[model samples]
Target: MSFCKSSRQQAILDAASELIATIDLEQRLLYLNPSARQLLVLPHDLDLEKERLTVKDLHAPAVYRKLDTEIFAGLLEGKGRWEGELEFRDSNDQPIPMQMTIILHTDEEGRPLWITGIGRDLRRRRRLETQRRLAKRAFDHAIEGLIVTDGRARIQHVNPAFVEITGYTAEEVVGKTPRLLRSDHHDQAFYDAMWQSIADKDRWQGEVWNRRKNGSVYLQWLTITCVRDVQGRIENYVSIFHDLSEMQAKEEEIQHLVHHDPLTGLGNRHLLSERLQHGIRQAKGQEEKLALLIVDLGHIQLINDSLGHTNCDRLIRMQSAKLKAKVQEADTLVRIGADEFALLVEDYSSLHDISQLANELKEVLQEEIDLTEHRVTLSPSIGVAFFPQDAETPDQLLINAQAALLEAKKAGRDTFRFFDQEMSQEARERLKLEQALRSAIKGGGLSLSFQPKVLLESGHVYGAEALLRWCHPELGPLSPGVFIPLAEESGLIVDIGSWVLRQTCKSLVSWREAGLSLPRIAVNISVQQLEQEEFPDWLEELLHEYDLDISLLELEITETGLMKNELKALMSLARLKERGFRIALDDFGTGYSSLSYLRKLPLSTLKIDRSFILDMGDDPVSLSIVKTIIQLAQNLSLDLVAEGVEDSCQAQQLFDMGCPHAQGYYFYKPLIEDDFIQLLAASSS
Candidate 1:
């Protein structure tokens, strides 16, 4: 009986050793009795002495995929135990499921010791055995649907988000292809492309319409990606999707805000440019024509000032509405800038169409807008340029339109001009001349000639009116008519004006030195100089520095300048006149102004513009207008000066008309100061 007991005990111990050696959990043996390496398939690189080894000795298990590294680390760092799920794989590539239990091994009295992990492989359990107790959690709680498929996009798994989004339950979706959910919004080519992406192991993200279980269609942002095996073969396709109708709407709203003007809801500068370029290409390809018409508000600034920005805005909005009404359905009309707008009229071959539209646009603005007790009217200035004739590019078209617009402004607003070949040549020459002018100012190539402003009764030279003359080194003496306007446009007029003022003062001092007794010299001030912010102070400084009597310096202003900026111009003239300087209104009667307004202005003289004088000998209307101007000047107690009096007939008309002073080509052409002084000597002698 004793011998039998000993043999039985040995057999029991042997069986226990075999179990310990064979059971697996992915750690070094560390002197385990047996079988751990065989079960875990521990690599040779793993040492028996190692305290820790990765579960990677096999494929990491599904449970390990869900393990939170942070939580496991926290447990191991402080509590001396970590419990988590770890997925694994065997040598044959079968997925291995695992539950890992890491516990602290301690000695007596609870002293800290080694960390020992005990693992249970659950490859046979499919993680459902644990889930029956724990229940579906993360996979079911996600907000966006998570859909999985085989390499062919056949349905494999669906989450609660997926079922909720698609209105399909897991039981209904598991085996059916994802195509069952397709809304048919996309063609077969789309799905073919998606499948090709899966086979290529790529990803695609875009909006797709999907039908619900009840056959209702809804848009969703779908992201489909392929999972590849080690050999780079497509193993699975995973798609995450969210509904996209609301998002797309918000995106479209942003795009509209970017491309359209909010106030008029017109295509803005950006959209205008884009359309113009497209139109250019179309025209070129079809051998067709397009016209760019630039419409400028002639009196927007004045309206904005008098009626306030509120009414101004309302006016512009109304104008835009009218513009939309006026343009063709296929054309694009844009309020491109404040006070500036544009229209792209395609297939235009003649000027009459553009001219008619220009007329209609202007007529639309003729309606009066009531502002409290007052009413104001506005008109437009239009500039037109035809494609292939004016320009080939959008930018060039814009410049051409601008050039024409400038001409309209010169034509006195409420007018239209077409781009002509002559305009381009003229612009180029003006640019060249402007450059030469700048150089002339710096190089002292500009000279001042003088003409006598005679007192008609005595024929005595009051003083020589300084006239601008440019002696282009190669081009000979260039007329101010050729380059003065160019100078004014380029903002070089201010410098030229300064030179004239200084030279006139120098000439007056020279006349005094020469012992020639003459009246005060008059200097022509352009509308720009009148608008100068520092005109009064500048005049004071110029006068005081010249140490000349203010009476000896006369400042002439145009009727347009005086009429347009009445109050400001009056203040400026008043300030100068207060200091004893003579103020003469140049080109009088050229502009229409209320007699009350004209009478209210402080004036020393009126220089009637040449237009009224050109036909004074034969035109009764012209003669009547001239006589009325002289009478008006007399009524205002202001002197009258008639310009462009080229003959005895006109001079006699002015004399008979009681015009007090006359200056013209007939009296003496504009001459140098020396020639003028000699003429004055002859007159005096």
Candidate 2:
């Protein structure tokens, strides 16, 4: 009958999922639930209706002792309840862990009657708790910043990376809004749009600028995801972000290299073209003037040859610095080539504004620059082309500016020129002439002529000046005045001048070999040739080749040529004089004629320019200049030669002025070699 009662109680307890049992004071089980049977893996053959069960039957001896000491001992003392984890053995002898909650059941007399206990299987909950701890570790230790916010968008927690990235401790940021990190780079509207996107799409990701605890701004790639509950209600917001400032800076650096010159850090050609086109469009819209200037450094290669490549590069950098410092911040400076740079100017008041800027650039280039041991100055030729006037496109503007630059160079260094239609025509003609001159120099279209210099007293030939003449196949008899400057400007003067010397020396040898007595012939040398480091040595070789007397060779360099590189000219002339070759200062009174130069130069004669001689009888000032030049030559003990004495009056005046020699059409026009030989023979007779 008692077993039946226990069976009824156990049947009622079967509804509970936990293991439930009733135990007597002796620790014998009076009733146990189906959950308890399954938890212990009891044999189906042992029926609770037939056999008795004890706690010692299920629990290990150690577990029983712990139960007796901590849980059951307290329950036996009439305590209300006792709860702890305990171990029990299953039928397979494997240990099962259970969380036990036991209550002391007693009669009205306050004596313990039985222990009512419930055991929950701890394995599943233990597995879940372990997983939770692992997830917490990952969240706290992640490298990317992590933030957890409540549904109200208030910060609840932050990862260690968040604290590190923001320089904010958890104490400072918890319960605060994300506004603490806002850099104010974005307005409320931006935030509103971002939130709206997140609300509609459940997530938003982009680059954001935020402030750190130290008030420094940084860029970061941020992603915010909305977490929802099972009912689709917002539960939390999780944000993950990483700093992107370094990567962004690297990208900007790469972009900068694409549009800037590597050497000078100025704009390159590609960027210049881009900016020019944009400038044009803007100017057209505003109805404003835009000026494009192409600046070419004249004789840059000459500087390079003289100063070496390293110093030349330093000179170029200095020029760039000057240009940048002088131009307005709005203007664009571009290094387009080795010796060529371009400028795009806007916000100008008028054409005069651009012109003034151009002049300023020229002035900047004129300043003396000291590079290491060398002191140098640059002469920049600037060409200006206007918008809607000279050209409408970038290409056309650049071409027009370059054409005008050629005109500026032709006008001489340290100048600026504006574009016009005439310059285009002139440029084309100049190119054709340059090509033809090159051909004439290479082919045998060039020859020499001898103009007699006569004694002013006897009217007899003393010596002749060798003149260069060219007869182009297409344009016959191009004069020396027209082609000589071209040769000098084109750098062909060195080669042409050398050839002239060789030819003159050969002529003298032939004359001597044929038994014809000839005076010393003078050859005009250009500034380019005079500045050659090897000129003195080259002249010695020529003198040895012909086995001619060095005293019979005279070299005439213009006063302007000597002043161009005074030291070089001084050294070269001194060397020539030491070797018995006579040197004449040509075109006297046409250049800077300092008494110091007259005293220092190794000159044998001073040749009066043709301009003074042509105007001597016509202009009183010219006559006075001639008289003064003769007196100056006399004082210096230098022989004087009056050029262009075309009339008897001019020759008589030159003779009265104490000039020793005169050369002009009045004596004889320049003659070919055969005619010159005949003249020489007659003069000898």
Candidate 3:
């Protein structure tokens, strides 16, 4: 082109997208098209010849230096044209990058007339290239898998993440349908619904079960969208997904832990309530009966105290396993407490069937279990409550079952009891008694009665046993049998026992001041009292407070209490004996009576249990038991006292058996403080 010669050519040059300009050999701008003016940011109204603008004014300084040395040198050396990237500066002094072609036009004389340059602004092209690079990088590095497919559902491209998730390389999956990844867990109907939704909404997102190249199935959260053309026709499909297999597995594990006992792997109390409620509903619908049995592993606290809690847990697991093996598949066994379990029987025929099952379950636990260090037997007590009979609701059934369990334990363990209205009444009465006893202990409604312990050889009062007595204002007089157990269960025995000790010391000092002296006063102690780690120190402080000798008070502990936790009881008794206090094993022959443990105890005397003493007159077995006990005491070099000695005949038999001491109604009833003093004075006379 002759560089904007005619109006038509000038108009075409002005409208062109490329920069078109002409400069003479002296580098002065001769003519400039509108595109060149705008690219250089020069005034469009200015006449280039009049303004004296040159190529140097538009080219950056560094770019002008390159054109002066290399570009112009090449164009003048018969090269005629130079094409490369060059920089142009705008009015703001900002560099504009351009791709340019410079042409050297010559006249008829073979001399350079002018140089015409055609350039294209490269900023927009550079931006498009940068965006393409970033998009490719994101597709390769994203955590979620990405897939691109053609409108025929054939895979066209796959990201590195897709290869990692599906174990399929791009070469293997390209041009293949998504059907290769189907796990076959979903039917055609499921896929049809998914496709229908996508067709309607242009997108679908949900969980899908798919197979990996390794033949393993997994869950994935997937989102698929249809890529459409301007005419709204299907062009491509883009899918993004993430593996949800690990998350789903974690959720299931959390659910299992929430509903199961961690130790035994059995159902827990929460699961029990749910299953019980469900079982009740099913029973009502089927016109069937279901029994809820509460099985209490009796004396577990004793086992825990004797063999440590770790072994106790092992024993509990063993028991749970046994109970599980004995129940049917329809039944549910739940660990409701540390040492308690509940059995839900759903397929029982009648009460007799439930009773038989309860007995079988109890007997299963009764079998001797071999703990690592000790082989021990368990005595399990079961309480049965029927659905729609004993209780109508799960909560009430559980409560009544527990109440029946208590009755079973009270009836001497290794047995089962059916729930009855009377048992609930007794449970309420026992709760009332527990509350009343707590108040009595704090309000001084309790007292101590003394029964003289006489010497069978001399008929002289040597000591008296102090008994705990409670007289409620409204209940008149409550038996020690009824309220004492309540006190022990409610943990009130510790305070009550301490109060008795202090009052007995006061009584001893008072009797001394009244010119009457009993050699020693024996006071009953509960196992809970001896279990106190500070019991010995507390007793010493109480004795010192009264200014009484420790020898003047005898501590009587039951054999059953002593045997509960032999090791701890032994240590407690040893500390007391070392402090110059006498330790007597009361109610002997009624508990374990194992000589292996008995001989190791630091005992001062053995009191024959009243049952043996009372029955010895009529039953030869009872007499032999008492005699054997007396001989055992003699052999152990321990003194003996016969309890429940009611007549001269029983006394003579005890004395003949070489029992030197006796205490019962025959000599004196449990007397008040004043009556005891009178008896003490008479004995002294």
TM-score winner among the candidates?
3
How does residue 217 of candidate 1 score in lDDT? Answer: 89
In order, what lDDT does every prediction score? Answer: 0.75, 0.87, 0.89
Instruction: Give one digit per residue, the lDDT tens place, for model 3 in 141-168.
Output: 9989999999989999999999999999
Of 1 and 3, the candidate ahead on lDDT is 3
Model 3 misplaced stretches (Cα beyond 4 Å): 1-144, 150-161, 183-193, 214-218, 226-236, 429-484, 490-560, 572-685
**Model 2 TM-score on a 0 to 1 scale:** 0.54
The TM-scores, one per candidate, come to 0.50, 0.54, 0.56
Clashing pairs in 2: none
lDDT per residue (tens digit) for residues 1-685 in model 1: 3558878855564355231221122233344322334445555354545544443344454444443354334444567566776555554666545576766555686654444555566655765766754645656786778888887767889988888777889998787788788787889998888767755658888878898888888899889887889998888888889877668899999888877888889888888899899999999999989899898877675566545678888788878887789989889888788878899999975778888988888777666766556677776788888898899999989888877877887888788898887776766676677888899999999888777777777666666567888898778888777787687667788888888898888777777777777666778887566656587788778767878677788788777655555655676677777777788877776677736646666678778888889987778998898888888888888877888878888877788778878888888888976787787677667
The 10-residue segment of model 2 with minimum total lDDT is 42-51
**lDDT, residue 75, model 3:** 90
What's the lDDT for residue 116 in model 2? Answer: 85
Ranking by lDDT: 3, 2, 1
Model 1, residue 431: what's the lDDT? 67
Candidates sorted by TM-score, descending order?
3, 2, 1
lDDT of 2 by residue, 546-634 (tens): 89778887889888877766766787788878877888888888886756778898889889999999988779998898899899999
RMSD of 1: 13.2
